[model samples]
Target: MADKEQFFSNVYDVVAAYESGFVGAYGNPEAAEALRDQIKSAGGIPDGAMACSTYKLEETGKGKLSLPFLEILKLYPDCLPGGAQGRGDCVSWSSRNAALGTMCCEITSGIPDPNSGRLEGAPEVTTTARLNGVLSTEAIYNWRRHGGDGWSCAEAAQVLLNDSGLWLRKKYDEIDVDFTQYSARNAGLYGSRTPPESWRKIGENHRVQTVTEVEEFEALRDLLANGYCVSSCGSEGFSAERDANGVSKRKGGWAHALAYLAVDDRDEIKKLYSEPLVLIQNSWGAWNDGSRRIFGTNIDIPVGAFWARWSDIKNRYMVAISGVNGWPPKKLKSYGARGFI
Candidate 1:
């Protein structure tokens, strides 16, 4: 409890300096533990699950998958995922919107740049268009957020799995309700209280099936290298806006939830930063667009997104991989594919 207070105090101090009015509430250590117990009981993540650590791409059949970077933005180019607009509904935005959308894109479109000479994803579901757009941030946030102040990534995962199920923009018709497209006002307005019951049930088809707790680097990379996406919430803040490399400077404060949509593990990037970079998508709408190509790669640093080093985030960042409904999709060949590494 003492640590949690100190954590929020630091957040107030750090973000207070910036004019972006960025509010950070990633839930403290105490909140995480309580949520973890609840998550396990709800069957979100198993008692002893080791998914990515045990995942292996068939050595002989799939061939060498050379990934200079795992770019999710390349898969789904809605760089600005609507925006949090100072709301604490980041868990909803990151979990359902960025993470789930990108994973669905991968499953439908295959790797952005498959240098492995094969398209690997569920091509059978290519006709499914609803999974391609931005989900309703308020639908989940309205139900799971703790009074619009904060919510953990795990809690958001639970919301996606069982509680409220998935709900996309009314345009996508992810649910029965005519939940209009997302906006800063609607997210803030409806999310201030519980949502109507009619907006709860996930579309009969689109639902997150499995949630895996991933605390290790190898595990994160393994899942990302495939077609899955990971969401995270941690107690940390950036000192300044993103630099030329698109890397946000760590300020050592803030409880914030965000998503890791891509990974930049290029040798050149690692050599310069001393570790790989994780492409983070923030809920803040176009909050920071200052970026440059660290190397000769077409990795688009979206408006609301930035990059962070693995060394800096490995310890404090808590993440969970959300596997979509269509698991183990077909591996289409990327013979003439355009993979953005």
Candidate 2:
């Protein structure tokens, strides 16, 4: 209990500091270091605070194939490739989830042979072919334009997944759409163009279940254990932080969508912290590539993926989208209030 209380207090202090004119520090390494020193001097952080590191198969001795859901990645490693380039942000991130979900369905139900002529009612089509279709930032950005900026993570994920067959199957070069022009034409809506009323229609086209109230740790573990990825949205945690010159800095809060790939076993992670850690893949390209290495050893997070504590996720995560093979189960229906339809 003392450990939990101390962790919460530390989080509160850090969030308060960031909200109270220390915002720039979050994007500046030198400034963040100075702020950390000040916090230490003020005794804000308690002794014996738990520390967690990003999940790495090698470091944890847990191979990706050991987890059934992640095994698909071995056959289709590029299914969740990174490179949002600030264009897609949450939209692209959610699209990655939708894509991964589709791939999982293919793996579980078996991919339809392109020459089988059974594409009409097939459970899933070619995984790589589908990935090739939606991998473009411009393609996803054009679909379901909500506001001038970007759609909420849920809105984007729902639309992209539901309409994936029509949009996600086409190659990038085959489509000639300009996201900049699309955003300019459809500016200031503040919500998804598809709207909540259209969810039923959307679901008719795709097999996905959106849950607003997840059991946090257990739900995520179960979903991953079943060979599925969860698409999540939250206003906390940092995917990437950089300064004016594009130098990576300290990690901080951001409203974003990410694909929850896997979590380290509770037994192994409990060795370092009071809670287990989850592995998430980000749309942001490699963390160490180019000018993005400023995060340094302070956060041992890798490029495109990182480990987040379960406590933080429980507190800040808002929703999760799990792909289903047939009709969504009855247990998931209780969490239906989260669906867009």
Candidate 3:
């Protein structure tokens, strides 16, 4: 059996490969609504969404490697495979979001005084830094080229905050920290700056649900505030011992994100994720360590417990999800100092 570290490392490499196109990940550049319409025209929800293959479904009921999963591909017909203007399909975001979420959960399972799993070179901005203003603007520029609403960084922050249950009830730029802009900035910056916009709103009023304790659901709640889907221990909590079958279980709110798709209530929620929901996209690869599902949990950060780096989260065990198909590109693998990819 592989060591826990090796297992996660392998998972990251595969996820990264899929995202970087090493494994033929595809998508369309059309708007999400458009793609949704196309799927509806084709045959409604695809039966293969649960298969875990990064391919598209054709009318013939066959699977082929193509851009955009069935759900979001149909809408973005113009979205080509590998280009500056390429837009990610919904599956792309789902996979990436789930993998990252899972990694976070694995490492932050328990609050270590000095957290592990932080990115090495991320800037250590103060909690109240105004860095989000720049990040929100940058995200708008990046996402806009791919066919998103021409939202400003500030606007994005507000949306993120509102989504996370922060109650950001103000117009763009009018609110100290916009949820839309802040949510994007949080993931992109990885907590470097909570966006002064958020700081101002949270100033002296650091009160949000499920954050003070740093439990699984609590951390997930924070992730939800930022606009990412979350899956976790399902209130089952964490356990240090492997189960009777030698499988480790994620009991409580371990901070992590794995890839997963949301489903309708009428369907038989398979319950693959954690306790609260079904399905979890793991960065730890195929071998299940008994973790939670990857959908319908909170992943937004509460206003107060937002940590700037993995270290800020005050836990050990850095979990990484890669968008590459082969070995992940990390500092240790860099042989030369060219400083260029």
Candidate 4:
């Protein structure tokens, strides 16, 4: 309890300083001063704090504010950082839970097949032959002229809620899922364009395949249990469900892919796919959307993003692998420890 309380207090101090005007200069001297005050109030020493042990001091030996802030971050990993690096751009389901996170929406806009060998650009490749333009056009058009209703991350959350029956409003398990309510409520408060009532139906005709929207948690869980990860690159290559040791399983979708670790006591997920936790592999390295900003902007999943029953998992990631050359040796013990994918 003391640990949790201390963590919250530290977060409050950091947030208060940022909101007060310490971060006002947009990374200028004034912002640094506000940060210093914030750190002092939060019971941190300023001069002694360093950005990182490895960061070389500036040529003139000037003390950098970002460094101290980074040190504070290292000390209290969960506290909101000094600036908006972890903040989100749009008010969506994520904002209601904790600090508004930095946007990591990789432009699935125009990515192409990796094997296509088309070097026009990364974004161009992703958006190609994908629903990027269609989805964007529909969303933008609906938001602009038609009731300001279009697709957004919030809408996606709503769809998840609606299908999961969480929108029906009984007793909620996923507190973060409740932020779906903000999609419209905050939309009104912030006076931003509202998302569309419905989204373009994902279909084979649209070059997108979708399962029937389901609501049963148990059934959803079942689907996820059987899903095999597919590459986002849209190539014939598919990722292994169970790793070599057969503990973690790979979960992939159109935008990103990661390995699934064990579930928590509450049945919450713990991903092992990415780094720092589990790395969520984005086609766009660190620069593009959906990527982490470890240096500047990045996506770091602490508690794992969302939980889906095996049914939903299967619907999201189902593939059939036929030919394979080499396979890993049998390791049943590892399977039990990690839950083979």
Model 4 root-mean-square deviation: 24.4
**Tens-digit per-residue lDDT, 122-163, candidate 2:** 223255443432333434444444433434444544444344
- Write down the lDDT that model 3 would get: 0.24
Off by over 4 Å in 4: 1-145, 149-206, 228-341
lDDT of 3 at 124: 22
lDDT of 1 by residue, 69-182 (tens): 234334434434453334445667777654454455545565432323333343221212233334556666665544444566766766666555655445434433444455
Ranked by lDDT from best down, the candidates are 1, 2, 3, 4
**What is the lDDT of every predicted structure here?**
0.54, 0.40, 0.24, 0.21
RMSD of each: 8.3, 16.7, 21.0, 24.4
Which residue ranges in model 2 land beyond 4 Å of their true spot? 1-69, 105-140, 160-166, 172-215, 239-250, 288-303, 324-341
lDDT of 1 at 227: 51
User: What is candidate 2's CA lDDT for residue 81?
Assistant: 39
How displaced is residue 63 in candidate 1, in Å? 16
101: Cα error in model 3, Å: 15
Among all windows of 10 consecutive residues in model 3, the one with the lowest summed lDDT is: 301-310
Compare the candidates by TM-score and give the number of the best one.
1
Q: Where is the poorest 10-residue window by lDDT in model 4?
A: 98-107
Clash counts for the predictions, in order = 11, 1, 82, 44
